[model samples]
Target: MKILALNGSPRMKASSTYHILAPFLAGMKAAGAEVELIHIRRLNLEVCIGCYTCWARTPGVCIHDDSMADVLQKFNTADMVIFGTPLYHFSMSGIMKTFIDRLLPRFEPWLIPHPHVPGVTGHPERVQKPYKMFLVSPGGFPEFEHFDSLVATFKQMARMENWEYTGEILRPGAEPLSRRSLQNLFTGYYTLLRQAGEELIRDGRISDNLQLQLREDLFPGGKEVFYQLAEGYWTEQMDKFKVPQEQRHTVPLLAKDLDSTPMAPAGSNITNDTSKTGDRYYVSNEVIMQTMTAMYDTKAAPNLQATIQFQIIPPKIDFDPGEAMWYLEINGARCDLHQGKTAIPTLSITTPYEVWYDIGIGNVDALEAFTNGDYEATGSQKLLNDMLHLFPRPEPGSDDPLAAELDTLMMGMPTAFNPEAAKGTNAVIQFILSGKGGGLYFLNIAEGKCTVQRGAAKNPTMTIHCPAETWLAISTGKLDGHQAFMQEKYRVSGDMAILLKFNTMFDTHTN
Candidate 1:
């Protein structure tokens, strides 16, 4: 079964909606369903103009390029669509809303699904199928005002395009969600998501008969009550309904692509009058446009793709192998909230493939699945996002970034561990690991040797101790440099700055 989960929170994986939706996706995956997750805030697509071009001129094409094009194809292949978001100012987030707007191109004037082929004759399937949703709001409220507003808006939009509205679950109170509650929510949510995915994958959209039954059970009061409750006129009466006074601001941008923006070439200048700051904010228009221009203008081959790798930890943005731009085919793409304000796990999918598959491709979004327990990742989010961004879209003929080529004929021999990288000649290796059973051990500088010990001051010179097991794993490639730190398998005290510098001098570890 194919399921597409759309996350509206810009904070990426940290968003509460992501948390709520993850378990559900896990359930689906466990049931043998294929799921794809698309965080709308991550897409570089632009907003839909009010132009009814899809209904008149281009038919099924929306003149924008950004990432919507990235989603349209995947949307068609899925049997279910799961929309997720936090209720902002009593409504859905601007990101998710704008995304829904751009989707206009996916529907014909008659609101039919676009043609899959030129003249093939087949059933005129509905534009979308019955779907489910998981929304996460920061705090709890007894009333359903916020939940109803979000669901109604999406429901109406789906209805206009011939989609069957399945059901939704509103998860209120973000931090208040305990591990126990999370598990329970996911158990039920997972079952429902997989069931929805399976039905869509097997029989296209849900049968009209089944859709009617599910709708009635969930809605209870039928369409009349639903429409009445949906009317904005009721909102005026709702203000007196007495709810929490919590004030929350929605995100400023949506999944629409900036690179695909149709405005005057951006002229190699992309700056923020006021920068939002952070990875969700990304490298900004200027950096990307500059990179794009540099890649295309260089005297290199016409097809050479250019890429820049940066390691940024605030007050410390460093570039490697010389801060020069090199032609690197965008061999792949990864989700780097390099700027997400929310705690959403920045996603990274690494492979040598030329093209990228969207969160909707597998009919599921990655973060959402992870949050719902439908997706599983082996490491910390920061580690995941960082590694994913390192996905090398290598320049067609460039050497591997991780491995250095010493001479023209042969590859350099790899090393197990280099004391030079971990320990420098600061009075002959003054290593220390303190507090709660943490300390240092000594290893050979030249012969690649080590003897791990427990007690204190055991010879301050040339020491290395990071949870013995981790130290062992490091030499064996069983542990990755990034994850080791995240997993607490690696932590350092004392001269960390100097410690990091050792990375440059040490013999590179290899498999």
Candidate 2:
């Protein structure tokens, strides 16, 4: 069987449409079907002028001399034609519509009763030949309903032209298919597409079950998640190119070109005490209060209520004088910051401003500082320990664990995997750790088994980003994963629901 596949995406090979189409064509080729793929954007086809010259004057020949003549000849001889396009405005792309219009020479001008329908009238085929038509489209939206109109149009076209409509391969939320970071997550989906192609060639039709599986959601998060990621990608492109605010609407920027530009080096604000100057580096009382407010995790101690007071002695400096006092009131899931001391405080910490600042910014560990008598505390010993988990530190300190330690922890994850919890799970979870012992690692989980890989994954069901120390602390049971996540100690992208399952799915204690 000879197949002609015309790709209508302007992005050509970089398009999500091609991402799905390529695998299907590969499957057809593997099944011994002769397949020829062509990009419609590369053709020099002219628009139809509605001259009716092909019907009355030339008969089976168009007036305009362009690439369409060659395409028409190939179309006439092929046993099957696959129209591959990216959805635009709930319909086929402009170039695809133009390409279809130029095929008027293949049909006669005389109207006749439709062969497939009872009351519909259509034009007769100029050259009688049995062929199959298939639609291959990928849309950015996550809903399958978005492709309904486009699919209906193609079905109607197949009926009018006296051709068999051999199903369609529709992918919703397909933007990620073209993204390099997300390719690994779609490995199973691509394999299914290939199988569909092989079945079509060998059995003359794709099974209904296969078609239903092809239309499954590309990303499990659905429409809201897709919109957020798509908007973020475009916003990142604009920022990468430094597109001016006034010209944002007028200027067109391509992420591919902008990615080549060198990025500015990231700088750190944390400095040693010796570098502190009255005009430059002193941490103000306001900064401490704001940091406390931002780091407070209400979910950490939702039921327990308490009041914590801080008595911060100011550093001896000419610009600022005297001590600073602040207190926090925690009630259920709410935390409020107030100036001055609170009456009947559950916990009271009195420390020099410099030492407390060091602990707050992750320069020194709080437990070490407390052990060395750097601070005086008069309160519940339980509250003191709970405070660390209640308001988790926002960043990792200067002393980060080594890469070997992280490797040891990652290696043990597979052994700790609970097959019962992961019975129905098939996913790739990527961990991107930064600072000191930071590197890329991913877990491939399938059929109740888990494998660890040390490089980037082509596709990942979810991605987690955090400092090496943070991950180490979480892995060793020193930190609460959910509390750290709520406190913004780590960031995550992709399926958040999967992250919530970590506790039950893996035994961190054994790791």
Q: lDDT of all predictions, in order shown?
A: 0.43, 0.77
Q: Candidate 1: lDDT of 191?
A: 47
Error of 2 at 79 (Å): 0.9
Instruction: TM-score each candidate.
Output: 0.35, 0.48
Q: Could you give candidate 2's per-residue lDDT for residues 1-511 as a string of tens digits?
A: 9999989999999999899889999999999999999999999989999999999999989999999999998999999999998999999999999999999999889988887777999888888899899999998788889999999999988887878999898887888899988898989999999999999999988998998888777767777777888999999877765635642321122222122122111331212233354332244665565455544665677675677778887675544533488877777676777777665566678776776765664456676667666777765556776777776653332244466778778867899899899889888887766545655567998999999875445567887766677888998888888888888788776788788777788998312
Best by TM-score: 2
Lowest lDDT sum, 10 consecutive residues, model 2, at 256-265
Off by over 4 Å in 1: 110-143, 178-511
Clashes of each: 46, 4
Q: What local lDDT score does residue 147 receive in model 1, on the 0 to 100 scale? A: 69
